[model samples]
Structures are given as structure tokens and as C-alpha cells.
Target: MALEHAILVSLLEQPGSGYELARRFERSIGRFWTATHQQIYRVLKRMEADGWVVGRDVGQDGRPDKRSYEVSAAGRETLTEWLREPVQPEAVRHDLAVKIRGAAFDDAAGRARLVDEVRRYRAGHEETLARYLAGERRDFPAGGDLDTGQRLQHVVLRGGIAYERMLLDWLDDVLETLLKGLP
Candidate 1:
């Protein structure tokens, strides 16, 4: 359901073919919302059928015809309704956290591995947050009035940064606990 709205929002930003939409998803919202090319294409078709978007055949010189999708008035109304609604909090689901909770059942070496994995995940998340911050700084700057789409992106990036910082702090606490127990 959120994916459908995401597709509509992407089309509202600008008209694009399914392939282009997939690429934009990877570059922009992939930090939080992930969708495969096939999934994006499928959602686009459904959106077109539902009258949320209209696709036009775009022919390029010496290239296959591509269908570019744009948001309709209906889509704008639907998106506005969605924006006005209360947002639901996402459920937390971390497989590593689950594994770490069960680390007592593992050997010493296994526990060490879990700690290492946690550290690696923290580093990767930090990198991702850095990228988001860089993109936001480049695009929106500090005191600029952003469009609806840019505002959404900014909110997502802020969330990413907060999440990463929390994870890093948690990792430090865990590592300290583990080190204290070492012989």
C-alpha cells in the first residue's frame, strides 16, 4: 500500500518511464523504502489501471517506445488525502538483534562473531547516513524552502541519521559490555 503511494509520489515529482522510476527509487528512497525494478513496474501498471497515473508512449530516435507515467488529478487528490492522514510507526525487525539476544547459546567464538557483525552493520548504516546527509546538503542546503518532494526526502534523511546514531550508540554499549566480561 505504501509502495503504491510511493509510486504515485514519484510520478508526481516528474514523468518517467518504469525503468527511470526504478532508478530514482534506488537513488532516493531506497534508504528507507526498497523496491525492485519488477515490483516498481508492476505497481506502475496497477496505478495506471486505477487512474492514479496516465502513461504516454514516448518514442526515441532508434530506440524502443517507452511508456512514461505522470500523475493525474485523481492521483493528486489521493496523495493529498494520504498526506493528511496520520502516519503509522514502523515495526522494528532486526535479525541481528534477535541473534544477539540468543548469543548465550553460542560458543565464545560465535559471540565474538556476533559482536563483529554488529559493528559492521553499524559502520554500513553510518555510511548510508553520510550519503543521505551529503545529498541533502547538496540539494536542499540549510534554509531553503523545499517542494513537497524535497521535504519528504529531507524527513526521510533526518530519520536515517537519527536511526544510525542510535544504532552506533547501542553498538558502543554492547561492545563495552562484551569487553568487560573478557578474561
Candidate 2:
């Protein structure tokens, strides 16, 4: 999906200024889709110009006035139309997989470097999994009922959690092979 769609969904969840939207993306939406603040600001401008979103300046104390944006009727229509379209499968682009394959031709020192890189990558995935688990606990707390939107969001977060777990498991296999047959 395009960043525009992600922004629309975010604004639909809660109207907010660009800064606030960026913060939300960093905290939650960034788990699936990522965008820099500058990119968000630029898109907000275009979306406003396209009449997909409306922005209003809000007064602030000790700070410049901020323009808060909310999805316009056209934006909702666009999102609805986009949602009905078929989703194509995404292509995998895994650099670590390439590195692991390339290690087959490397010297002992080079293979060791590959192992170190894999360990570093595994560490990052472990941290992400921890964060996902923490977020699930903080957000869901109980297995109680959730609204449709919340349920869907929770499912998506669960997918991320499962993906991280799978990656970690696969990395362990890779690590074992790498260490066992070290050059």
C-alpha cells in the first residue's frame, strides 16, 4: 500500500498534526510501514492540495502554530476504492540470505565475519520481538473482547510477532550450520 493510504488510515484513527502523526508512525505504524518526518510532511501537503485531506492551523503556546490534518470525504472514498483492489504478493529482498549464500565461497575469516553479522541481525530481531510482546501486553492486557478495528490491529501485530519468531528460529538454524561447518 502507498504511504498515502497509511496516512489516511492514521488520520481516520485520530486527527493530528504532522508532528503527532510522525510520532504515531514511529511508535506503532512504523512496525509495518515506515516514513521519515519530511516524507510525511511532503505527503500531507500533497494530500491537502489534492483535497484528500483538510488541514487547519491550531494555536500553540511557546511554539509555532501547527496544522492538524484530517481525512476529507474524498480521502475516505479513495481509501475505500483502494481497499477493494486486489493485493499482490510482495517480493522478498533478503540481504542476509545473500550474505549467507556468499559465505560458502569466503575464507575462514570472512565466514567468521558473516557469523558475526548474523548474530548482530539476530539481536535486532530479538529486540523487535520483545517490543511487540510488550505492546501486545500493554494494549490487549486481557483476552477480552475488542472492537473490530482493535481486533484487526491486534491481529496485524500478532503477524509481526509471529514473523519475528520464525526469523529467530531460522537464524538459529543458520547459526548452527555456520558454526558447525566453519572453514
Q: What would the per-residue lDDT of candidate 1 be over residues 59-167, giving only the tens digit for each residue?
A: 9999888999899999889899998999989767778778877887887888888778878887887887788778878988989988886887788778877877887
Best-fitting candidate, scored by TM-score:
2
The lDDT for every candidate, in the order shown, is 0.83, 0.93
Residues 1-183, candidate 2: write the lDDT tens digits.
Answer: 489999999999899999998999998899778888999999999999999999999999999999999999999999999999898686678899998899989888898888899999999999999999999998887877899999999999999999999999999999999998774
Q: What is the lDDT of residue 78 in candidate 1?
A: 89
In terms of lDDT, the best-performing candidate is: 2
Each prediction's TM-score versus the true structure? 0.85, 0.93
Model 1 root-mean-square deviation: 2.3
Where does candidate 2 clash, by residue pair?
none
Q: Candidate 2, overall lDDT?
A: 0.93
